[model samples]
Target: MDKFLLQQQVLDRLAEDLLQVEQALREAHETATHEENIAENKYDTLGLEAAYLATGQARRAEAIRQAMAHWRQFRPRPYDASQGIQLGALVCLVDAGGQQQHLFLGPDGGSMRLLSGTQLVQVISSEAPLGRAMLGKYEGDGVLIGVGSIRQQFEVLQVD
Candidate 1:
């Protein structure tokens, strides 16, 4: 799969998420300011609750905006053997049971799955645990990742 195309797809998905978040933020803000929601007594906290929800929605919208900015500035380059696996590398790893998993290493705030043709590829940040373990690893290299108390092992099958 073309890395540039995949990057574009990620950006498109993030854009959609941003739109949704903004809509929710707008609704929450309106609800918070609505006259009907104003509290008449101390126990009546509808307006206060709505204000808190609006604040949370605003924060979520800002986060999505930042993620979109990061994705826009990101550039995916061709993989080099000397560099091993890094951001922009499409890596395939195989477990002991011969199960193959595909991952696209990318920038922050892109931990989501995408469909490339019939295969589903997981997009992750290099700072993530699995991504960190795969970094600087070449084909045929062994990768080990520990999550909580569980350990998972996989061999690098391909890097492109």
Candidate 2:
């Protein structure tokens, strides 16, 4: 699998998301300027609530833009599993159920699974729980990641 291509695919997916988010932010911000957004009474907080929602949406859109910028500047290096997991490393793991997964340790993109030709690439941020557990791990190692009270076993097959 080509890591660089996978990276680009992830970025493309995030870029698509950014577009939708920006459009949503525009709609949210537009609400504040509309006359109907005005509160009916002092106790009615419709206008104030619209302003808050628009502000939050703007921040969210900005964050996604920053993540895209970060991804654009990143250069993926060849991985040596002995060095442990790091950003830009493509990792392969098998779960206790015998299911195999291909994961990319990325700097910012999270919860995005992309289909890169025949390979399925999952982009994860280092701050995420599963991403954190995968970091600093070598091939042939075992990891137990907990989702709530259940701990799932995973075997590190390789890192590319």
Candidate 3:
């Protein structure tokens, strides 16, 4: 799969999410400032509630903007066995059941799943549990992650 193209796809999806957030922010702001929403008494918190919603929406919009900036600057490099798995490595892992999963390790705030052709790829950050376990691991290496009380195991089938 083309990593560059996958990056573009991620950007496109983020752009859509940003647009929705911006629209929600605008509506929230309007509701907060509308004359009808103004509090008539201490118990009437419509205006205050709307203001809080607007603030949250504004913060969400800002976060999306920052995520976009980070993704724009990200570059996925070619995989090297000697270097082991790092950010931008496209990895395929197999579980004990023989089920395979594909992942594209990337920058933070871009943890999402997308379909690249017929294959589904999960984009993760190095900070994630599984991502941290895969770091510096080579092909045929074993990766173990604990979720609650259960421990899941996977083998590094391939890295590209």
Candidate 4:
């Protein structure tokens, strides 16, 4: 797949994930509010439990909102097809240990299932080691990634 197609795919996937998260957060918030209202008229034990659940739900809702805000400002440019590594490119690499991997620059979720044929590694942010190395790199570039105390070299075989 070319860079443009890959970029479009990533954007589409990200948008979909954002929508799902937003919906879930809305549902959770509504449920929590309902529970809290019901508990307000009940015993202290039930009210406490409801308050706890409501707090947890509120936290999750905030997190999802923050993530959605971040995604909204994320503008993925068209992939540079000139042989170098660029954002939105699907990269295939062989690690030093001889393991083959496919890395997709995307949000962290169950979206890995969308990558059916190859192994999918979700890069939630650009600061990660592998993610950092892949940025501004070209095909055939070799990068060393630190995993815990061990450092492994990965060769970029292809960029899609």
In order, what is each prediction's RMSD in angstroms? 0.9, 1.7, 0.9, 4.9
Ranking by TM-score: 3, 1, 2, 4
For this target, which candidate reaches the highest lDDT against the unseen true structure? 3
TM-scores for all candidates?
Answer: 0.97, 0.89, 0.97, 0.58
Clashing residue pairs in candidate 1 (N, C-alpha, C atoms within 3 angstroms): none
lDDT of 4 by residue, 12-77 (tens): 665676577557656655655665546545463554554566566567556655655555555555
Off by over 4 Å in 3: none
Name model 1 segments beyond 4 Å from true: none
Q: For model 3, which pairs clash?
A: none
Query: Relative to the true structure, how large is the alpha-carbon lDDT of every model?
Result: 0.91, 0.83, 0.93, 0.60
Worst 10 residues of 1 by lDDT: 59-68
For model 4, the stretches where C-alpha displacement exceeds 4 angstroms are 1-46, 69-75, 81-84, 107-113, 116-123
The 10-residue segment with the lowest total lDDT in model 4? 107-116
